[model samples]
Target chain A: MENENMNKITINIGPVHPSTHGVLKFVVEIDQDTIKKVEPEIGFVHRGVEKMAEMKYFNSFMPIADKLDYISALNWEVLYATTIENALGITVPPRAVYIRTLMCEMQRMMSHLLFLAHVGEDLGNTTLFMWGFRERELLMDLTEEVSGGRLAPMYVSIGGLYYDLPEGFSEKLLSTLSVIESKVKNEYRAMSYENGLFKMRTVGVGIISREQILKYGITGPNIRASGIKRDLRKDEPYLAYDKIDFDVVTEKAGDAYARFMVRVNEILESIRMIRQVIKDMPTGDVKVKVPWIFKIPPKYTFVRQETPRGEAAMYLVTNDDQKPYRLKIRAPSFYTLQAVKELFVGSKVADLVAILGSLDPVPGEIDR
Target chain B: MESSDTIKGRFPTLLSDVPSTNKNETVILLNDKSKLKTVVGEIKNHFDILFMLMVVDKPPKVFEMNYVFTNYSKNDILTLRVNIDRNKPSVDSISNLLGSADWEEREVYDMFGISFKGHKDLRRILLPEDWPGRPLRKDFQVTDEVRNWTGLDLKF
Candidate 1:
């Protein structure tokens, strides 16, 4: 054992590696390029958002909530809003729910596009990254047209949305959606899916077994990729998801390629949901009247919503105070991060980036 | 959604009377924190995973630790809440039972200053290893030590 220890070496991969997506570090023990152990070192971006919630008012924390999953801001915003709404026993207007649903799907498209871009770049495909961002820009423009914020919209409020859909927003969105849909089906396939080199890097790179997934409580696309067929939206419908119809994309392989395919198919699914939401959205007040200063009675409310990365939950503890007594933001990435060791161990160093990118964990959410 | 009564009936000995909270969420406060291992171990048949371990600081009393478990096949969620005395501020680690409890327990230790009896690696997860005080505690004061934290002291 002592002699074996002398041959193994440990290397540190960034709290700031370009391909890490955010500030994530990995301490790896390697024996001739084969990983013996991978200890994921996170919390570089821990902003104490949960502690911040205790200081801020109930309604004032939306801005902080928006920053949790920076990639899919709307989903975090919606989850936070829904937790408060559920605690207060307030039902949002039908129109607002539809709008929230539509915006969330759009954010899903944005997030998944970024995932593709990041993963593509990781596998040495700069064009795929550019292509991913190119389509994502159209979404940023559309969301900006309505919400006026590119990354953190701050559009979602306690009762409903801050603003109604902008003029000609539907027409522009429909056109953009079709363009993305076609590009995703054709261009994305031509660039990565059909490319032999792409398959070589991803097809069997990092595989998460069903047992590892359940053991780590992995949710969302990461879980779906492992063939469990579990999605919070379909299992327990929240927001406008009950009315909208879509399939929960799943892949049996549970490898890096399957994870990629799952998110790619989810983009198409989101496009379908967006179209349904637009056609069926009822016209009504965007937001309900909420008092400037109101307190939610003492109660514990837990609201889990399906974000692009996975199932994100926000648990709110209120004590008849304007601010939450304790606010726990459960980012999907946090649980997914827990399984990094189980997933990465026994894999090659080259496939490390491939696996991490496939899971798509945002440190903002993980550290929060 | 099942109420606290239905869940309590499953584990009669150690489960105390706990109030029901929200739809699809049944909160059960355990009578003994030590029984947590057995309770979770027994219920592992129905629940597939321990989704999250949430710690709520209820000062002047104790820390209310909630273990959220989910049964994906049945589409059910159960929150097993245990009260740890503020003085002792410790509980049994369930990481061996459900693999996800490892980091969450470490997180609780990091934020709430709650120790796990048999946690294999119960170090600060989200904060620096030498982070001065538990920030999530209600009475935790931000002293000059926390104020002067440059993070440069972080060895890694």
Candidate 2:
């Protein structure tokens, strides 16, 4: 009896659980119900992408990049191609930049919608889950129409896109945006944002302070939710983000609710950006002529893109050849997953999945 | 907060001349690996965030480790490059200074086999601990079993 009272129970959560979002396992050390310590056991989906990138050609790595975060595959595609473009000093046309920006914002909205569905299920609310996916299908349709693939869109290429925006893309996109904006504001908002049960579960369940965000290197919506006014679009201004006008969504709470609210508002902001892109889209070639055998000089460069989850950066070092000497992908989920140790401590076992879902980590990127 | 150019100017002896890039990013090369921990500490005085740490295997024998830091207040980026001997690669750990470095350093240790002297719990984060040689190293070769299966002795 004495030994039982003294001993803390160790529970294994998963490399396959539904709430984990992906193959992420955690060994939770607990005493009765309170979580004492959580040691995450990741690397389940490590496909050796970095090692594989070394063997592939500089431009041939786009397909591999798409696998990193399939939720926002276009973002990864654009990021990889842009890094290569930066290294080789290839300039993309203004029309191409606007189209790329449009695709990126659309990816952001899709990712957030999926996250909303994930958060809903994690909290045992199937209504929000259903509503999220229902609204998400519209955006997914638009994505397929514009990018040529629904999930893994390998549309973005070095110097520009795989092809120009098809005729009537802007018109179709504008109508879809209005419908999404209304659904999100009227129907979807009530299910998660305003519902009593949803608020009770998320409002203050997993509070991530600003200090925790910086110390743990958490970025994207997570950092913005914690009241940090930092967005790569506004700060770094890659692509057509500099020309567009939209507010950076932020909340002061730094809790689960705040994270949810931030992403929701960001969907609205993305809608605004997409509208601006369609309105101001210039006329020109979508892609420039890049060499078939792309060779980079001896140099090192880092290119950053603000993804749905956070900032995705690529650090490339070339050795005066067609192949990259070294390429390191800095995925946002990698840092966010590490911060979970600090976030999970002192939280109840019941709230574990809720907290984990709110962070919105994709194992593909985390283990890459 | 001091700008990246100003900070790079202060330590001419410790750093090489700043390289010019099309993006106008300030890149400072550090020839000395021993002074890395102190240099990072100095950078922290101005830039509070260590944006990223990337290790590149330079083909014949050098290993270049880049520590990217950014001053959030000023939007200035400072990249510190440290060249380490491939045969004996080690650097003082800055995990004590920044909590973010704990996992980043572990990852560096795991992927490149470059030990961080003061990292509290240095273990493999991505690959299995028992996995053969550093996979990210340019000279890493496939095991005999893998080579026999593929009919090629793959070497990165």
* Model 1 lDDT tens row, B42-118: 66766888888889888888998988888667666788888889988988999998889999899889998999989
Residue range with the least summed lDDT across 10 consecutive positions in model 1 chain A = A11-20
How many clashes does the backbone of model 1 have?
0
Which structure among the candidates has the greatest lDDT?
1
Off by over 4 Å in 1: A1-3, B1-7, B143-148, B151-156
Q: After superposition, how far is residue A323 of candidate 1 from its true place, in Å?
A: 0.7
Candidate DockQ scores, in order: 0.81, 0.57
lDDT of 2 by residue, A189-278 (tens): 778899998999888888998777768778899988888888989988999998989999999999999999999999999998998898
Report the Cα lDDT for residue A298, model 1.
Answer: 85
Output the worst ten-in-a-row residue range by lDDT, candidate 2 chain A. Answer: A15-24
**Tens-digit lDDT track of model 1 for A152-264:** 99999999989999989999999999999999999999999888999999998788887898898898898788898888889889888889889989999989999999999
Q: What value of lDDT does candidate 1 attain over all alpha carbons?
A: 0.88
Regions of candidate 2 where Cα sits further than 4 Å from its true position: A1-7, A18-20, B5-12, B22-24, B142-156
Model 1 DockQ (Cα-based)? 0.81
